[model samples]
Target: MASHSFQTVFAVPMTCGGCAKSVSDSLYKLDGINKVEANVKDQVVSVEGTAAPSAIVEAIQATGKDAILRGSGSSDSAAVSILESFFEPDARANQETPDDGVTRDVRGLARMVQVSPTSTLIDLTVHGVAPGSYRATIRQTGDLKDGAASTGGIWSDQGAGDGSGPRGLLGSFTVGPDGRGSAYINNPFQIWEAIGRAMVVSRQDESAGPLKNDPDTVVGVIARSAGVWDNDKSVCSCTGKTLWEERKDEVERGML
Candidate 1:
């Protein structure tokens, strides 16, 4: 059997459990599909099998949602590619890594990272720290990859406590003098909840005013959710460009 793995980002937003289940059910109908996992929270879908990438993309698009494949590899090469992509420049630039050597990056946005079926104990390294608090999240992909029955979770730094929170998807790890540690996401639901909470947190702002049923508030929430934050400057990164500037750039690039 041909095996492949990759990650992608979904243009559409998946808010609730029902929305996730609907997409999962829709993608399970394709041929040559061995397994399908969906992380509604992370807006990712991971697949493994001999299916063509184009076919997988089509199946997802057919469900009225937008999907993009970020990377892919076949057989043994697939595993190497998946691991390397985790530390790529583009991926690293998108996340906030402390100068103190605490780096956290999101892998397989719309796909769940998977290991061999028999493998357990997802090992991870936290480079550059000496016993500090951290949290991690494990996300699974839905039907975006060709259908494959594979699921894997990565270790994250969960502040304090036994790393049990939300859906038991949250985990805590302490780095030794060598700046390395490990954790695991054993249950599927735990992985699901971790991704879900991430989706919600990525779009939420605690500093924002009280939630109301007003349309303006809804719009504000959407804008804030999509907006990026600069920890060093502590301001809205979106403010750097004007609406017309963005539109002009998009038009110039034929994106408009």
Candidate 2:
């Protein structure tokens, strides 16, 4: 593996050694991949490299098998945010909708890993959204009481800004006509500093200043996620569903 490279674990359904071999061989063709280990007995594939986790999952899925990211980096070095729209919270005040339902609110997912003490890698993916450029920023607070508006101003680890500093910008990505977008960003920030903060992905242009009440915006709280070998449950204790079963539901909802 390259210097500062981290390992990522994925749960893939493998029936035999051949299945494992096929998966490993496919991963070896990808750039930045230093090592690939596939275990049929455990139906798990572990990779150590500088490649984006999203790309790793894509390569594994291309092998005719579904792959779910079990973990990444190490304990305390990884985080995740499930970005969802809060456009009509009052209209659906009493309605409960599953993420995979026809009216799913999930718009994107962000996976963050601290590669160095001063740097982090963010693998961001968005689906079922408008086709346009989106700017992502870390908000000062995790409050979502009024959608993105309630999240406050942009967060800057380099001290406060006069409401228009670039330090708070985490960079931007463009969603294609397919209503999907993906970006592997290398930002100068640690994962721990972002925990409990709010992440806003807004369709509004950055030149327009901080987005206030942008209906096309999606918001979510940054939370600590499992690291390599930190998660091992085969089935969700709360949902009573296997890992693959849950993956299927996510894919069906355009989360792939």
Candidate 3:
């Protein structure tokens, strides 16, 4: 078997020794993986083996954390490419439409459907919207898909959103003549956020106090929600509190 090794950066909220072990064990389960070494202090993981990078990433994701392949190598580079491949360009380019119809901008119409261990697919519908170039920001939180938790991380149009400075455009979506179209953005932020929100809701339902001593879940939720606020930059007034404080306040007020 051809021997290959590569390093990937993961945004892991490893608050304790147990959390680090959990992440390591999860990565070690991939096929063709010879060994998995994680640096809890630096949030980096190095995998050695002939396994495909995508497979490794999928395995890590199955553990309910976000990871991205970084560094140099065919495997690492290819992994990034595979992730980016999920994004599809405009289906109906340069199409004209009626001037008096209600138009839903691209960002407003895009719907996030399925988020798998390694991928997220969003469906965008342009029905009943006017035709024009609309910009939108796609952001996400870092948490487990099934777990009720939150984390922080956001991926938006390269240069078309709140933080885009002169290059960023506000949230918008385009409408076509047929009023139907779609776009897809692949990143780890949204997955994390979904997981974090679920965690918050779960704890809320259980009547559990705000996450204390649970650094992973706490940081995860804060990171995720912060991303949401950043997309607009108006919410929270950009305070960007830590996960612990946010949880404390929410729990005290009976809010998750």
- Judging by lDDT against the true structure, name the best candidate: 2
Expressed as tens digits, the lDDT of each residue in 1-256 for candidate 1 is: 2243233222223677776676667667766566666777666666654454445666776777655443343222111111101122344334544144433231211222333342212223333333454444332322111111112222233532243543324345554555444333233232212332221101112237421211111110000111011111222367776433544553343220
TM per candidate: 0.29, 0.87, 0.31
Candidate 2: give the clashing pairs: none
Whole-model Cα lDDT of every candidate shown, in order:
0.35, 0.83, 0.35
- Residues 1-256 of candidate 3: C-alpha lDDT, one tens digit per residue: 2233333333444566676778788767766677776777756666665455445555776777655443323221221110000111254222343133322121122223123333333322233233544333222433432222222223332422234332111133444665333333332232333432211111011134422212111111221111111121212435676444544554443221
Compute the lDDT for candidate 2: 0.83
lDDT of 2 by residue, 1-256 (tens): 2347899999999999999999999999999999999998888999999998889988998999989899999899999998888776454544554233325377889999988876788888888778888889888899876668788787865733234465558877898998889888877777888999999998876466756654568888999999999999999999999887888787665565
- What is the Å distance of residue 166 in model 1 from its true position? 56
Ranked by lDDT, top first: 2, 3, 1
Per-prediction tally of clashes: 22, 0, 33
